[model samples]
Structure formats: structure tokens, C-alpha cells
Target: MKYVEKAPHVDPVRMRHITDEALLAELGVTSIAEARPWRRPDPAWDGPATIEEADALIGAEVDFLDKGRGRSRLYGFHYLRWMTPLVHAYRETGDARYAAEWDRLFRQWYGTRDQVEGDWPGLDVIWYSLGVWARSMHVTRAMAELADEPALSDECWAMMMKTVLGGARWSAEEHDEFRHGNWQFVCAAELLHVATLFPELPEAPRWAEIGRARVLEHLELDVRADGGHHERSPGYHGMVLDAVHRVLALDPSFAEHPRVRAMHSWFASLVTSGGWIPHLQDSGVVWPAGALRRGAELGVRPEPGSHLLDASGYAIFRAGHLHTVINYGPYVGHELEPHSHHAALDFVLSGWGVPLAWEAGGPPSYDDPGYYDWYQATRGHNTILVPGEEYTEDRKAGLDLFHAGQHVDVFAGHHHGYSARHDRRIVFVRDEPSYWLVTDSIDADAVWQVHGLAPWKPHGSGYVTKNLLVVPLEAPDEVLHGNGPARIPDPATGTAEYGEIHSLGLRRADGRFTVALVPFTDDPPAVHLATVPPLASPQETSVPDHLRVAIGGIVDTVSASTWARADVREGWAADG
Candidate 1:
């Protein structure tokens, strides 16, 4: 939490002056009325369409509001698209009607606050809403255009200042120093913007100072040299970068800082094939809409030599390579925040703009019976899980371990039921152009069962591939496969020869039994295993039993008591 607290060497007034002059000149506006038209425009349905089409899109958004069916709260942003055109039409045409409608909508939304009123929650939501409000405020010229009725403008300014600045205060007060490091930067950016725009406010400088310190602290702690946000979600990674860029844009001094440039470079690396990010963990809930749009606005382009999105969590840029991996160390703040979804140890991998693999994102309905089940289970992500339910029924889990570099690594957070008996680990490693993942499990007891089960039913059959060993397994039966007279080694060991072997054993915990999987590489790494109870009778079939086990790399049997480990050290590796 340490930061440089001296007054910035650069002058704030000069920075604000330059930005305002540039913005006004670029948009070709003299007064607030002149600014309105440029603030909002219709969506470009076709390439460079007429102003009429823009008007039509604006009309359509306004119509959505009239139906009384749009989003049900004064979320601020819901009014932006409609408000934009209303302001523009009033400014360009000098139409009193357009101006009135714009004022009416603004007042309606701003005056009538959240029914269950309180400051907005979540740093991202607050920042996003403030951006929208700032645009509105700038276009209206501090409500000067509403000169005939100054009270309305005054009220609008008061509401906005209070909400936005108050949001900053809340962020400063609520931050848990140990976790939520990224939020420190995000909230500070919004608060700093408020301070920059409303310099006359007595408390503005105080908030600005706090924001400055928080930004410095975040730069030192949360941001890695490679530029990855400590949490491993591609969506969140882009979000943090976007937040940083906003701060830097407001204060050019921030632009010169090494962390600022590093962040810009790192975000460019996360773009994957087809412009998709590895949709790891809860990131699949929403696409990278804001990130892409903002990056485009900033004129930050991906590097020429590399693809937009790399399979390994790194973005290449003219400066160098930036790591796009999510770092999880700073997630402690999420415990109190509303947007925190229960996903730990899950990561997305993208290459060439296509999400190569992903965690199945959340279902739309929070009220659904399977909500917790889908959100918390191992099958929800591409990470390893221990047998006998290691996840809490509510789906909450701990963030036990994390490290970042050329590759990112994360460890298990909670024991659904194995807290007393076993430990689980999943590691993702990338060697430049190629990538591999290692999943390991350690048992406090030598004798335990290891189970590898996928919740989803495999397509067209009841069989599943439990690739727990290094060598490929041979299909011996419709339900079972077996392979490997080969040696399975432990992963922690460095040697590629003298493969370590462990006996496969089974024992019951809770309602399931444990199954041990020995390593199949020379100098076998420590065994990582999970427990799976025998498939229940089909008569108890409401759950749809689709579990299968394989030895080595082949699907062999529905139930197997014995399997062998191989000695292949180059490909994918697993733990038992």
C-alpha cells in the first residue's frame, strides 16, 4: 500500500487545459449546445449512412424506454444512447422540443434514484457509470444550456458530483489492503477524473491525492512486470487495463510511468484468434465489448508481427511481449463486492483470436436450481477437482495460491469434502509457441481413492476420457480402456528418467471412494489424484450417469480397479 505522495511534478491545470482544448477542437464545438450533436449519434447501420439513419437509431432507443420494459433501475447508462441523440438534435437544429426531451429524461433518471438507495456497488460499475455521466456533464456544459431553469442544472450537477465523488470516497474507505489491489487502481481512476474536472470543489484535491497514492500502490503490487492482472480472467484483465488507461489519459504524468506503458502493452497481448480471449472462469458471462471499443478509441493497436490474440496468455507489441494471464492474488476485495462470482483456479486459453478452450460460463437465470451447481463445480471450469465434492454447496471457494510469468499457475482453494484427507493442484505452463497444463493432487493419507469425473455427458455415449496418465490408453471394452505398463512419475521431480510409480488404491470418503493416479513420466512428478465412487445404479438415474475412466490415453471402461502409468514426459501431465 506504499505510494509516492509528493505533489506531482506536472501541473494539473495545464493537463486539463490541453485535454479540453484538444477535445473541443477535435469535435468542432464552441458552446455546450454545439457540443450536444457530437456527443450522441445513431449507430452506423451501414458504412457512413445519412444523419437520418442516425436519427432513426436514436428514435429506436428512445422508443425502448417508452415501452416501460427496459432495465428497471436508474442505472445511469440505460439513458445514454437515447440522451446522446436528444442532445445532438437540440444543439444542431436549435429545436426547443429536442432540448426539453433531453432535459426531461435526464432529470427523470437523475431525480428518481435507486429505490433501495445507497452508493453504487462494484468498482467497475461505478467507473462505467461515471464515464457516462461525465460525457453528459461535458456536453451540457455544467448545465449552462439549461439557463432558463438553473435549478434543474444545479440539481443535476449536485446529484452527479455527489454520486461520482461519493463513489470514490467509498472505494477509498472499503478497500482491503491485502486483496482487491486492482480495484485500488480502478476506483482511483474514476475519483481522479472527478477531481480533474471539478477542481473548485474543496475536497477535490484530497480525493485526488488519495487516488494518486492508490494508483502508485497498485502499480507496485498488483501489476506484474509482464502486465498481467493478478486474477486470471481475460475479461477482468481487459477491464483493469481499460481502467488504467482512463487514469493515464486524465493525467499525462501517469502515462510516463513504467506501469502505465507496461499495462498498455500487456492488454494488447490477450487478444486471441477471432478477437476472442481465452474465456477462462466466470469471464464467459460477458464478451469483451467495452475493452475492444475503448482500445480502438485510444488508437492502441496490436503488434504487427503477432496475432491479435495469442494462445499463450501473452500479447506481442512493438515494445515487447506483455503477459495476458490473470493473477488471482488481489481477489480478496470481491468478497464484499456484488460482481464477484465463485470461480477459482479456472483459466481461459485463447490463440489466433479463437477461444481454444473455456470454462462454461454462468447461466442467465440466477434463480435456476442449478445455479450454484453450475457456478461452483469442477466441470464449470477446465481445472482439476478432487473426488467426493471439494466445493462448498454454496459454490464459494478460497484462492490458495497463484504465481505469474511466461506461464501462470494456480492452486486449489477449498476442499468440498476432502479438507482433512487430500489437497488438489492445477498448473498451466506455456513454452512460448506451445502450451501444456499439469494437474496434481496430494493426499495426507497414503491410501486413498482418486476419481476423475466430468459433469457434462460426453457426446453420443456414456463414456468419458479421464486422461490421468501420460500414455494413451487402449479401448478394451465398451465402457473401459486400459494401457501403460509404462512408468508414471511425479511432477515436482525434475528428472526426465527414472519414472516414479505409485500403486493405484481406492478408499471411500463421504459417499465416494478415492482413486490414485501415478505419474507416467520419468522422474515422475508427485501424483495428483481425485476420488470417484462407483457409478450409481441406473435406477437412481435421475442424475444421468455418464462417468467413464481410462488408463493412459484411451477410453476403456466404465469402472476399472487397475490401470498403468506411462513414461511420456513431453505432452500433457496429470496428478493423482
Candidate 2:
């Protein structure tokens, strides 16, 4: 009924003739004759229009093999991820078209292969390790995830099992990115899934051992002590989480490990009141993956509240209506930079019922035109940008201090990207629960920006989004033409990669400004700024200046140096 060759490297002493009943029991089934009750197609998969997209794949007009959104460089569309939709659609409606299409694609791919080199010579023609990894998952899903077994020619099914064993052997030794990227999590998922699906193979036991060991090592090496993924992208963080969840859900061995639980907690910490994770690093404004929702059912998250992760420099504040996540620190991995941005003190803000500000140029086709010029540039973020600072490796930021509170909170960060110092402090006041006092102190001229959910229009005295008003206390006469372009997200079907958010900018000569962000609807709110210029101290050049800012009738005296109400000053960025 099935076929597999013993790989050469598998230890013969470790081999065990596992019975058919035990393998079926691993999937919670009594016999191989009965259908597997627990083998899901894709765990943590979340596409807004999954059925519609899957159904479209059955149409002749839509080619499931169209690589890349436009760049033709992506290998994901080739043989990988195409099976998920067909299998998903088939399960949803018992559609014969979905099955028929899978048969068509499978034969087409199988026909292209003539021989094997290190298990996959013709399979990975375009690339080496990446092709092997992708094909391994694809073949595994075709044979394993679809337990109902798409009706295929007997020859095709047997050929698939042979490939499965070959893939296990080849992948057991290959170029691994465990220390640098998300590939390790993906590899671990694939290896474990292989072991669980086909333990009768001689290599299955060793595959399980290798997969578990990698997972354990990943918990220590790839995930930071603060629980954030070393790559620094929350979207990727969720991806790695989903990989771990799906494979372990099949086995149930390491679900309760302390590190695993902590990983779940870290992802949950970024969830906004609106149920979406704020864009961070290369991620976009996105909803949590199905796996994250599944993890919540397992009850692994820590206590709820506003708090700070000092190691990763993420100060997450979540309230009933207001949500914000700010990140800054030494670069996570600069050797082989993970998908990241040059954003420091840049944050995503959502209040009332709409998104205020968000990250820009979400994971684009890596070769997209604006991939470096705009998406990864410092000016692309909602932070101060010096003119000469392009999206280089040196563009960096680090948190100076963080203070969390129920009614008020504070965050201060600094970056010297263009050989000039820029310090930013944000004070969150919850009296009204939808306001912020942001002060930026820079030693050089800079272009301050805001990546708004909507394109910025000339709204009276300052910029305004759908429901948020950005009122700069120290106003610039006009916004410079150098900034303000729309950032497009990757067109992957399952991912909600934010939208075409616009980057708005204003040039400042002295690079010193205090801004008030207030969320309101209907009538516009009144805002006032009274600058108390330092009593012209010729003797003391570093005298602290103070000011009064009034937003929608609420007023407070903010100090330029301390970045908070004069009476409320306890810590400053300079304290270190």
C-alpha cells in the first residue's frame, strides 16, 4: 500500500518495526482503514477570503503556479502552498474540481523529475536548500495532510511516498538558518510532521529525535530571553509560532514546556484591544494567525496589562480603546540582517475604532522597487528622519527608559542615524484615554513624519486621519515635498498585509517640536501651545525650557527636557 527506502545515515540500532496500530493511534485513529480524525490541512492558516481564493484556484483563468506577485522570484507558488487551498476547499465543500486540480498539478510536477541527487536534484533546479525545503513540505502535505487521500494514479501515490522518504533523508542534512532566521521553525515542523505521519520508516524515529532537538535548541537560541523572535518581525514571530503549533498539535509532547509557554505569551503581549497585532519590523497591521488564536485556547499567556519588555525594548500599552506598541534597541541580528526596518521610536497607534498610524511597506516581494528606497528607509516610518540617512545598516535606535502606568505612561528613545542625535519621548495620558504628548529633540535639521492610515490632507492647522488629529505644537508652515508616498503590501492571499498607508512629513529647521495626538469625531477639538522660552540665560546654555499644551480643553505644563508635566517629572532619557 505504501513504499519507502531506508536512508543510509539512520542508525540501524535505533530502528524499530513500529506497528500499524500505534502509528494510527498517534493520529487518534484505531486503524489505517478509518480516516484520520486529527490531521488538519494547515494549522494557524488565516486568509480573509480563503474559500473564495481557493475556489478561484480551480478556475482555468487563475494559474496556481504563477510565481511571485509580479517579480517572478518567489518559489512559494511553484509547488508549495498550492496544495493548502485545494485541500482546504475540498474539505469545505467536497468539491471534485479541487481534487481534479490537485491531480493535474501533481502529475505536472512529478513529470519534471527524472532522477535524484542528494534526494532532490531535479526538484530544486531553481535553488538548492530552499527548493528542497519547499518540496519537502509540499510532498508531505500531499501525502500526509490529506488523509482522505486525493484520488491519484497508484503510480503517483507510490512515487510520493518515495519522495517523502528521500526528502526526510536529504533535509536531515542541509543548509539550515536556525541561528539567523525563521527557517529552523519551518524545518522542525516539516521533520516532525514527517516522523508522526510515517513512523514505520527506519528514519522516522531519528527524524523525530532530530526535530525535537531542533525545537528545543530553537527555544533557547532563536527566541530571545524577552520572548521575542530574534528576527524582529511580529508577522514572522506568528509564523514561527504557527509552525511550532501545527507540528506539536499532532504529537502533544512539548506544548507545556516553559519556553514554549513563554513564546506564546510574548506574541499575546502584542495583541491590541482591537484583536490585531501592530506592525513591527517588516510586518504589517495584521490579525493574529489561527495558531495564535489556538494557543489562547491552551491558556499560555501571562497576566494582562500595559508593560515593558526591557530586553527587546518593546513597550506595549493596551487599554479598552487605546493601543500602542513601540520598539527600540540594539539591532537584533546585524550579521545577516533579518527582514527589518530602520524605524526607531516609530509606533503603531489605534484608538476609538480606527487605526491611527501603522508600519509601512509590509513584506513586499523582496525585489520590489521601493523595498529599500522607501519601505526600509528611516523616513518611511512615523519618526523623525534626518536627510542623509538612507536605509543603511547603521540606522539604529535604543530605548533609554520606560515607565508603565494605568492612567499615564512614558517612553524615551534615541538614535543617531545621520551623525546627529535625535531624542524622542512620548507621554501617554489616559485621563481621556486617547491622547499623546510627543516631544522630539534633535541637534540637526530633520523631516518628522507620520505614517497615517489615510493620506494626509491639509486640515486647518495640522494633519488628520479618519479619526485622529496630529497637532504639532511647534508648527511648520508647510509639509515638504520630499516625503509622502503610499506603501504597498505583499499580495499574498492569506496575509492581511495592512494597506496603502501614506507617509506624511514636515520639515523642521531646528528639529525641536512637541506634538499632540488626539482622537475625536464630529466637531474639531481646540488645541493650544504656549512656549515658555528659557529666561534667555546667557550663562547657562542648557537651561530647561517649559511649555503649556492644551488639547480638546485638557491642558498641562510640559517640560522640554523632561518630556512630561513639570510636576510629574521623575525620569528623563538623559538619566542614563
Candidate 3:
């Protein structure tokens, strides 16, 4: 394929289906006959067609600052999902009217885009505009079939050249670290697509070369040795991976790259049997099944059954139809805000395609107080929480055991969050009625009071003991919400919304607790809690002056050790 004339590697058949669906949604029409609701040549209707019933189809302004982050007042115009329908209608149906509408929309956008730039505040705001420009220009250039008229074709070409020059200049001037990781990927991929699509332009070759190099370099750096993105957020990991996939689609040579395949492999293995990826860091709850399928097509396959990502400190244990994920790794620190969470050595369980215990749902909006209070807090995860303390981004983690052979998988690590040393061990036995055991040892001076926070949907049931606080998770309105003094600007509202939950809390310092989790494909399993006597004296411990002062009482001399074992009963008859 000639690089200059090449377009996005979209499959015509699949694109047609996707376009058809988009058209139906945009126009609110049931059939092709109803697709063109507006007059065939409504010159005033310059933007994409909107449903007749919709009052607010598209916003007029190109850059309304109030929407926040990458969002624009004109959401549809920025996303331009409506392009497929416009291009498809014009190309397949031979409708000059559709072409005219496309022309009008292009001119309207071009005019607004120019005005918005003069109004931008600073260099930071430029990123949002850059993203908008990239997406708009990409759509316009790729849909070559829509520009049928000579005048429209010439105007489109002029915009293309302008876009290429401006984008290329930005790429050359901007340091790699300035717009690093996801930003680098976005800019490079856009430039690559533009330069490749229009190589006839004088700057095409240079821009394309630069774009290729930057993308490949970041692709290596952004993804860690364990195959996870350095951002440490599973949400951004999938997003960045999807962007890489698009680049690979345009140029297939990169598919064979080891780093690329490792990325795909990581994603494929990251998903729980419940069809949900671990909500690690700032990642969302939605699964990326399509990305996984594409990864497989690109020869990036998951481990045979179970495996561990040592560098990223994630371990996956799979037995029969059940799947579980354990995180016992260091905090991944990025140059900027890493979005790392305090749920170190936390684990999530699932069976078949149902989530038994979920990570906190995605953060709904960055502006909401609940974002920091609950969604991003240690209490939001399935891990131990210090009563009056918070987790910090300290890389205090070490692996104790990692063996996934002989029908047994064991993984253990220690992390220091809340100023306490936490040693956690997980043992997955793949015997009849497969079950997993979680052992947590929190060592802290008497000054601090620790609580084990086992979170699940409100529907689940559990008991609360003197060492445990079992109650339905309350909303931010009900629970105390605290945030750090320093605040950062978050762009988009994440998908996670807070809801009531069932929280299993343990308030015991310098203690070890064991719980067996057995996931069921259908209904919630039956759980029984039992006390296990210590086989040996607990490990040596000491109290600090600060802890003694904080506790304001005599430190318990007995150094008592209490272990509770919860046995789960799931109907895995065949396995048993």
C-alpha cells in the first residue's frame, strides 16, 4: 500500500455496520427512509443531523471553557462520531445533498476553530484544542469520498495542509516529556496518520518519521517490564492500548514488536472471569473485550491459565471457570501525578462471568467531593484501612512467594501504607472445590488502630466481630470524606459512581487473619467464619513512643494473636 494515499485500516464491512448503527442513533430513525429528516439541501443545517425530538442537538461554540478538561461545549462536534454517517450516506447513496451538508459542516467548524484558538488561556489549554483539532482533521481527511465537488475538495485539501504543518511544528517543538505517555501517544498517532495519508505534502516524510519514532519510544516506556502501563491506572492502560492498536492497524509492521505483544498479553490476562478488569489505580469498571479480541488477532495471547506480572506486581489465579486477581506491588510513580491508589496487596475475586467482589466502581466526576473521599481512598478498595490515616504513594513492597505450578498458586508481599507494615500472603489451591486463602499481617505500634476493609456490593452478607466492623457501605453524605491539601485538575468525569456497599472491617494491629474465598458462577456462596488457634507465637514486635502516646493507654502486654478463617461454600461439585 502507498503510504501517502493510505487511509485508516478500517474494514469496509465492519465500518458499514458500525456506520449504519451510528446513523440510526444520531437521526433517531428506524429505517433508511427516515434517515434524512432535514431538507436535502438545508444550507443552515451545517452541522451533523440531530434527532428531531432532541432539543439540544449540538452546541454552537467550539471552545466553551466551562465543560472542563478535554470536553468541549460542542461534544458531538468534537467527537464527530456523526462523520461515519455523513460520509457513508454521501458515498453509498450518491447523494449530492449529503455532500453539500458535509461542506457546510466543514466550513462552520473551520470558522469556529480559528476563533477558539485566539481565545485559549495558555499552553495547558492548548492540549484540549490540540486534541479537538487532531480528531476533526483526522475525520475530514480520512473521508476522501465525501468531498465530491471541486470547490469542497480544494478547501478540504487546504485545511489538510494547514493541519499537517501546524501539527508537525507542534510535534517538533514540544519536548517528549512535556506531553508524555498518553499525550505523546495521541499527538504522535495523529501526526503519523496525517503524514501517511498525505505524503505528497512537503513536510509529510519528516513528520511521519518523527511521529513513528516518538510513538515507538513511548510505547516501550509507558508499558512497564510487567506489561502494565506506568500510569498504574488500568483505565488509562486500556485507553493507551487502544490508541496503540489504531497505530498498529495503520502500519502492521509494529504488530510483531515484543513490547507491543506484551502489552496485549497483559490486557488479555488482566480481565477477571466476570468480564471485568481489575479496577487498579484510576482504571474504570468497564471491560475492553474488543481490545482483547484485537490483541488475540495480533498474536498477543493470554497465559495458558494463570500467571503473574512480577514487575507490575499483579498475580492472576484461574481454576476451572473461576478467576481471581491479587495486587502486591510497589507504587508506580510517574513524572506527573501517577494516579496510584493506596490499595496495595489488595485482591478481587470473580467466577465465570460474575464479579464476586469488585474494586470500588469508577470515579464518576473529578469535581465531586466523593472522588477523593471514597472512590480514590483506601476504604474504596478490598484491602486494609487505617482508621484515621490515609495511604500515600510510597513504593514499599516486596514479593515473598510466586509459584503457579503443581495445582497451587502462592503469592505474598508487604506494603507500607498508613505508616504501617503490611505483610499479605495468598494461596490458591486448585483441588476439588477450588478455593483461595488470604492472609494479612498488619504490624503497627499500639499508637495506630488498623481496620481490614473487605468491600463488596451491598447485596452481599457478612458478620461483624469485636475485631471487625461489618456494615453496609454508606455514601459520602453518611461517611466522613477527607481530601489532601494539594489539589490537581482532573479532566473528565470517570465512569465510577458511588453506591451503598457491604464493608467487612477488622480493627486489630499486629495481627494475622485468614479468609477463604470461593467464587460461584451464579448465586452468592455461603460463608462460615471460624477461629483458628495460633500454631506458634506471633512474630517479634515493639511499640514506638508515638504509638504509645497516640493510644493514650497501656499497650496490651499479651501481644495476642487472633486468626479468623471464613470458609466459602460454592456448588463446585465436579471439582470437589
Best by TM-score: 2
Ranking of predictions according to lDDT: 2, 3, 1
The whole-model lDDT of each prediction reads 0.37, 0.62, 0.51
Give one digit per residue, the lDDT tens place, for model 2 in 1-576: 011344233222111122355433322323233323224656544443367767676644434334334432444444356556876676678766776777666666555543312222243432333455566665655554344544544345434545565666655664233545676666676777777766655667888887777777787887777777777777777777777777667767677666677777787787665566666776665566554666677776664777876666788777777878776755555332357777777877876535677656455555567767677767667888777656345556777767666556777777766577778888777556257777777777777777776666666577776667777765774585333334322224423533566666777777776777777766457666666664465223222367666765566665533445434543344423
Query: Regarding TM-score, does 2 or 3 come out ahead?
Result: 2
Compared with the true structure, the alpha-carbon lDDT of candidate 2 equals 0.62
Rank list by TM-score: 2, 3, 1
Which residue pairs in model 2 clash with each other? 44-291
Instruction: Give the per-residue lDDT of model 1 (tens digit) for 1-576.
Output: 111011122222111112244433322323222111111211111112233533554323232233223222333444244355554444456555555555555556544433222234542322343343334333333233443432334344333334444454454555424344344456666566656655644556886787677777777676776555655455466656666665766665665566555555555565433433433433432234345565555554544433222222222221122122331221223443323334333444333332322344433333334445554344444433444444433333344433332332222333333344223343333322222222223332212211222221222212222233221111111222212111111223311121211222222222222222222223222222222454456333211122233322432111111222232112222222
**Candidate 2 weakest ten by summed lDDT:** 9-18
lDDT of 3 by residue, 214-262 (tens): 7787777767886777666677777667657657756889887787888
**What's the TM-score of every candidate structure?**
0.49, 0.82, 0.68
Clash counts per candidate, in order, are 54, 1, 8
Q: Candidate 3: which stretches are off by over 4 Å?
A: 1-123, 128-142, 149-161, 175-180, 334-336, 445-501, 509-511, 521-576
Q: Every model's Cα RMSD, please?
A: 14.4, 6.3, 12.2
* TM-score of candidate 3 versus the correct structure, residues matched by position: 0.68
TM-score of 1: 0.49
